[model samples]
Target: MGWLSMPLSSMHPHSTPKAYLDAQLTYERVIDEPAEAEGEGGPLPSRKGLRVIASSCLRNKVYYAAVAPTTDGVDGPVFAVVCLVRWNPRAKDGYVFAYKDMDETAGPNEAECPERILALLSPTENHSALQWRRRCIRNLARPTAKLEDGMRIRFASPIKFTDGYEGQEFFVRKRGRKTALAISEHGSARYRVTNMARMAFSVVPQTKVHRTVF
Candidate 1:
């Protein structure tokens, strides 16, 4: 963790990404219908703030993040779409990313943030430049582990995330060398994964998830 004073924008007046990044590490969540009482389905989720995961921005466009599709939303594998966006009368799925603006669709979040992380380094040290480069490399590299159907992996990081859960994992359904489709019985939405997010993951039996999820 380091202090980085990025160019001040009315968009992000703060000088460091750590404050926002750290806030995303954990979040309060609300899923499904906006009800105030328990019913036949289950307990109702609160209107409190949600834990933001990944984010990216396109000019003034902004976005929050989410993990899964709501019970009434569409289902399937997709890279992303505004229809999957959330946190308002707009996003019917769930409150994932909170977009500040729109480009005929949704806004962006941290996914597109530049790699120039302002780490704490001495301006006078030549080695500092090398160290920063190395850290960025490690942050951007894709996961090397192989993925196949039926395997489980944790959502470590995403190269391109349209939909995701911050503190959840998924079971692989379909996969490629650099990407895979994953499903979750818990709080996770069925989202795609890139090699970067596949790092340092854990495996769980499908049956175990089934028995425990309910």
Candidate 2:
């Protein structure tokens, strides 16, 4: 009956409000430069055009923000923040309307959109984002017989890279019942990992698989 009471299918990418919150916390940035500052520079991760902070609420509230750099003026810094509320209790598709303006025809406050974008330029969030990225990179592989291309497989035991760096996972280039051709994340080398029948592969989260920005 309540937003939080919605079924799991309602939050497709997340299983619980905590999971959704983690996704938000793991995706936002707070920048040091003014909203007007040009040319981008920040940790590769957590860099986006929008910084989002979300809280669990009956309507599943989320705050989308853009921040401006501190200034010599009394205003200090500016924030262009927009709030969005989930209107549907059974779907993930309609949760995108800008808060109070849930009407499909009503757009967000155009005046503040630019200011909010400034906050997304920060890279401080990357420290935690990268950690989460690596952690989420893993998932239990299906049966070795079901291995597919692009799947990063991890061995039951750890393995070392040629340059002395150690890694336990490799991208599956070619799958086989007994063995598979795989490549490393570094892409500098190709090697064979045996005992496929006993191995598990890692998968990137669907939300991140196609991410081109922070």
Model 1, TM vs. native: 0.32
Q: Write the per-residue lDDT of candidate 1 for residues 1-214, one digit (tens) a residue.
A: 1222222242153322333333433344455665556767566553434232333332222222222222323322211211112222222443323322221112222232233322221132335334434543564665456566667666443233343333445666643444444455433335543333324565655554345665
Give each model's clash number. Answer: 18, 5
| Candidate 1 Cα errors over 4 Å, as ranges | 1-126, 138-143, 156-167, 175-178, 185-189, 205-214
lDDT of each: 0.36, 0.39
Off by over 4 Å in 2: 1-145, 161-165, 175-189, 200-214
TM-score of each: 0.32, 0.23
Per-residue lDDT for 132-213 in model 2, tens only?
A: 2223223122234466666666654455432333456666665444334455544533655444443444554323366588
How displaced is residue 164 in candidate 2, in Å? 5.1
Q: Model 2, residue 83: displacement in angstroms?
A: 61
